[model samples]
Target: MESSKIVKALSTVMDPNTGQDLITANMVLHLKVDAPNVSFTLQLPKLDADYKQQLNFACQEAILEVYPEANVHVHMQNPAATAAAGQGSGGPKTNNPLPHVRNIIAVASGKGGVGKSTVAVNLALALQELGGTVGLLDADVYGPSAPTMLGLQGQKPKVERVYGKPKIKPLFAYGMPVMSTGFVVEPEQAVVLRGPRLAGIIRQFFEETIWPPLDYLVVDLPPGTGDVQLTLVQTVPVTGAVLVTTPQEVALADAVKAMNMFFLDSVNVPVLGVVENMSYFTPAELPDNKYYLFGKGGGKTLAKKSQSMLLGEIPLVQSIREGGDEGKPAFVNKEDQVTREAWMKVAKNVARQVAIRNELLPETRRVEMK
Candidate 1:
């Protein structure tokens, strides 16, 4: 007699195509109940007769178990067809690209611990400060740092029904929308996720998240070229990549391997520029002194090799490190004028490089899986 119970019962039925339950998949819509009489529409991925009949029978049998005398009326609809007919907002099944986002900037590195996530988070915030609407996606499945760095740890993105289909709503941090695997699983759980699972999560983040129109979407990629990087280029058209490295030869060596992935003939994503993180050390007490702790000129060297410019050199400062650990990036601390200027400079140069890339070339194509 209650609708909640009816919804719960319907949730038990599964959608074979997606490997999810009906309710979890957001397939059931417009359910009306009058005790013994239940009617609802089911949005399907395909409209094949056998597929439709199978789903319809499953729904009726599920409801019958709860109310033996119930009459169930099942209606079927296809989003792709409806959208093509001008009756829907391109239904959930349409393979529509992110036309609303002007650019997708990927922050990457050849190895870990190069401050790639720090640069990505600060760069995204700095871009927002410069009057551009931006979002962040932490695509590092194994070591998602956004949840901790963004001060959004232990929070989960909410799923809501949009156009009768379920869509994930990103968590907002520091006035920007953000998505990351850290939101769904703990660091311990992420260690076991392999190639296909990682790709599925990355793909879902793009296809299911209801991201608003954005001027730029900053994606923090996993270190080096692997499944996450390959899946990224395949899922969405990356605007460009900002390679991150330190002033060390080993880091630069590995970074070139990552850079070459974008340069490959089949996957030709443009290199935006280079960001040299941890270039030097400047103690808070001695603000005037700069000491080279990790060697020098690695950023510039990589820039020359990649045919791109050095975006900026980020010095190692206590405040910058503490801010990252505490979920308040240095770019927001007005007292750290030097660090703020460094990030803002990177952001500005990135914006300019993206503009130039878009102006001079065609939109980068999504790498097709062979």
Candidate 2:
């Protein structure tokens, strides 16, 4: 029943990367005990798909051996894996000195085409409307959709000098500053870059882009827990992460994996909560009728099981998808409709959760990079 005993048992689990026990690798964080239940998060070095799967199975086995009755939760963190996190100073550099940007949150999904980018775009606009300066970073190097979603397609970022260093100024859209790889490269060209080169490009996007002072910088991450995700976590001092998923078995399953990635020992990024998108489909004609296009409550169930908040559930609206395809998100429209209302609710929930998180953890002063 003692958590210390559980910790000691975990010490036997070795990290293949370091060839040392997880305890010796400093992979365990936030270990807690409550009677018969034991909970802790495991952090791991940036791991490839094969190693990640192997580690996950090994952790489960270790937990069962320690406490067969205890509920075990394993979270994986990939340190210095993505381009954004990898490009930062190798050592413990102080946080970036950007007072205008209060917090940077990444919107991530384990699978693509789940409307993650759409949610991110609307959420950023919604945050701005809630009386905060916002910046949107399209870190989806493979398919940077912010440009199209925000109706800024084919627009190039203006160049400016910041402290004698050249920087690319973000394009403005509805009072929000937006930057994306889409603006820098041809759509067809980006799809061809290899993994390492893609990481370099993402790093360059952060370094070369000129992001002004803002209240929130929401990054739309590339789908999956791969090199790109790892790179961003390492380079940027992300305040937290938001997992987006549809209320379907497949999406929810992958979403849990994405959440586990953040809980990993090396990743250690706080998860704000899970946002359920396309929870139900409602035809415009039948505003009152809600159709369960996908399985119901998958997201809410996942949130409950993980003990994380259910930020909000957005219905499947044709207008929402049409708006994104047309390069104008529904949230930006002033008309009061069901779709707009849904987005507004999601936005408010995100802001409220972020405010609470900020208050609880008090923003870490920007670390200085020497």
lDDT (Cα atoms) of all candidates against the true structure = 0.88, 0.75
In model 1, which regions exceed 4 Å deviation?
Answer: 1-96
lDDT of 2 at 140: 90
Quality of model 2 by C-alpha lDDT:
0.75
lDDT of 2 by residue, 300-347 (tens): 876775566888888887788878889889886666377777777777
The local distance difference test score of model 1 is 0.88
True lDDT of residue 171, candidate 1? 95
Minimum summed lDDT over a 10-residue window in model 1 is located at 90-99
TM-score per candidate: 0.75, 0.71
Candidate 1, pairs of clashing residues? none
TM-score of 2: 0.71
Among these predictions, the greatest lDDT belongs to 1
